[model samples]
Target: MGVIKGIEHVGITVPSIEAAERFFQQAFGAKTLYALIEKGGKSQEGDEMYDKNGLEPGTRIIAMRMMRIADGANVELFEVEGGHGATADAPSHMGIHHFALYVDDLEEAAARFRDAGGTMREGPIELGGKEKGPGNRCWFGVAPWGMQVEFIHLPSPIALDDQASSGPRWLPG
Candidate 1:
């Protein structure tokens, strides 16, 4: 195996790429970086690739739209055409469950997300302890595409410890 770089971006499946583009702009202050409509391209989970193949006479992904969270990573949206492939939804499918983003101000981030029609699922978890360490973490209600996003404020650099089974138990401090 090779050393891995950080996450580049996440792709999301949408019925309408245009709708997703608009929603990201309005809801999360995301900006559109690039978009293209490939008449005949390789079909991906969110993309519709069209070609005259064995299964169908001609099947393909007609269009795709990609947006980014400001200067951050991007979210590629695909608008697949029928007969190309079946579109899968969240829960059962194997895709991105949530992308964790680090923010400076938790209050402001939450407010902005909510004001822009976002819903909050988890809370401002004060993450700090001798064992757990210090930080703030929470999960967004849902993205415009119904995907979950997490906002975390880490006090210090930390990594997940697989050996650490249970958290420190409180003894009525």
Candidate 2:
């Protein structure tokens, strides 16, 4: 894909950034790197921030924190003054429904998720085809901050590897 490299980070909006950071830390060992816009406020004049960022009028950027989980994409949590925290109940909902994380041990991650106040879907549903490979168990859960997340563990490469152009997807180290 040329020298475009890859995604550096994914921005997520949360109502309570403190809780979000704590949840990610306790659930997945996410480490906070630094703060970008440490303070949250409006542009105060000409709706500059809103019009410039294409944000709705009066949407103030509360705060932002950069984080890393293993070697995956950096997680940027954004706290906005007018942001509404909506939790999705199904994967088919509109927009980006969820983000998946690779785990070496699904059970341990689930335990941490539960301990962090996340409500996980019942059963560690095992995939039945070669697409997901063998010994692959996928579990879905809601983060304490109302974000939907998936934890997947694949013991071996999936059959889809043969049909890929990007080779194998990146896994956390």
Candidate 3:
């Protein structure tokens, strides 16, 4: 059996914890649950444990704040000491540059993000161009760490439908 239940949290490195906190609060209705200004880094054992999932040592994650979302998942905001993230000039500069947050309303989410001092980079348009389903999605304010946060409002009927449909029609064998 898989040894995983669900995601505990996702660390997001940012420049300012307060700013990021405010943005998340407005954008996704996230509330701050805890905060810490850690020096150096986390414990070696802790690092090792998390490393299995993709954490590493020597990273200068200065400040961290945990926020509680409506779905019970925790969003950990990490503010790194040095500048670490994609730059506006180089959009393709890889690494964890963005994360999508599923929201109920697109316009409301975008408005809240702007009100909370976050900048919207692109449209609340239909994604999955020329695809099967109507993937209505939207992009939002850049994070302090220079990552883009997208607010995705997927189709409700498909999301809630319980009936399973056939995968793909048979092909000539």
lDDT values, one for every candidate: 0.58, 0.72, 0.60
| TM-score of every candidate | 0.62, 0.80, 0.64
lDDT of 2 by residue, 83-138 (tens): 34232421111224578898888889899999988989976888777746668888
Pick out the ten consecutive residues of candidate 2 with the lowest summed lDDT.
86-95
Candidate 3, residues 1-173: lDDT per residue as tens digits? 26865577866656676777887887678988887655455622224433453333333455678898777468887665433433432111222557667777788888877776677876866666432256556666675456687777655223322335633322112
Decide which is better by TM-score, 1 or 3.
Answer: 3
Q: Which sequence of candidate numbers ranks them by lDDT, best first?
A: 2, 3, 1
- Per residue, candidate 1 scores C-alpha lDDT tens digits across 82-169 of 4423334421132366776667767887777777667777677766553245554554657655767677666554444542663332
Model 2 spans with C-alpha error above 4 angstroms: 40-46, 50-52, 83-96, 128-130, 161-164
Instruction: Give the distance in Å from residue 46's predicted Cα in candidate 3 to where it truly belongs.
Output: 13
Ranking by TM-score: 2, 3, 1
Instruction: Spell out the clash pairs found in candidate 3.
Output: none
Q: For candidate 1, what is the TM-score? A: 0.62
